[model samples]
Target: MIATFGGGCFWCTEVIFQHTKGVKEVLPGYMGGQRENPTYEQVCSGATGHVEVIQIDFDESQVSFQDLLEVFFKTHDPTTLNRQGADVGTQYRSVVFYHDDKQKQEAEAFIQALEEAKVYDSPIVTAVEPAVTFWEAEDYHHDYFNQNPQNQFCQVVIAPKLQKFLKLYQQ
Candidate 1:
């Protein structure tokens, strides 16, 4: 099944999902935007209404959507509006662009449950919206963490998230 999530940088989400057992592929892209074929720079400008998202293809039999949801909610600060870490702007806003009614319902219910449980100290601001056209980012963005392990951003920001994910879910 396909799941598209906009949770801060696609770089971070892309790396985490790539390490997931059942995730067949994680493609970095722009979603929840009105612009067609938006470039990374345009999305970064936060004027195109695009969010940096990763469109994931996962095998539900191996890793349930619930598992993915758990990881997504836990790894990032969903309470923060239009930001994740130092990355701030509309493009970094938390969102789940569901492809179908089931996905929409599931995402909504997940957020509801989290709210009820008081999972975060603050309210969950993650938006659950219908999936829109996914414009795949440039080829250089694909597998960015793998390719740019030595990058400062990858080392300082993404590495820690990867470690935490491996500890919590990959155990």
Candidate 2:
């Protein structure tokens, strides 16, 4: 099964799902956009209508979609519109690009449940949209956090966030 999500920077989202069990692959890319073959710079400009998303291929037998959903919510702030941490723009907006009706329904219901429970202090602004064309990002973006661990952004932002996720989900 495949799930595509846009919660924040692709690198940040990529690292989290990469550590998840049963996640066969996590590919960073552009989705929810009208532009064809958008580059990272173009997406970063936030003018292409693209959101930085990771298309996760997972084995449902080993890990359920619900489990992924839980991890997704816990790792990123869905209440904030068009932003996660200091990364602000439409590309960082919270969204689930569902590949099928089941996925769409599940995504919507997940967000609904979170809203009903008042999971966040603010209203959930996650968009559960149909999955569109996924333009695979440049090769350099794949496994970015793992490859660039020495970089400050990876150390300061991604590393801490990844540790927090591991503690919550892996423990």
Per model, state how many residue pairs clash: 0, 0
Q: Which stretches of candidate 1 lie over 4 Å from their true place?
A: none
Q: Which 10 consecutive positions of candidate 2 have the poorest summed lDDT?
A: 162-171
Q: What are the TM-scores, per candidate, against the unseen true structure?
A: 0.97, 0.98
Clashing pairs in 2: none
Give lDDT for model 2. 0.94
Please provide, for model 2 over 25-141, each residue's C-alpha lDDT reduced to its tens digit, 9 standing for 90 to 100.
999999988899999999999999999999999999989888899889999999999999999999999999999999888988999999999988999999999999999999999
Q: Please estimate how well model 1 matches the true structure, expressed as its whole-model Cα lDDT.
A: 0.92
Backbone clashes (count) for model 2: 0
Off by over 4 Å in 2: none
Error of 2 at 42 (Å): 0.6
What is the TM-score of candidate 2? Answer: 0.98
lDDT of 1 at 168: 84
Backbone clashes, candidate 1: 0
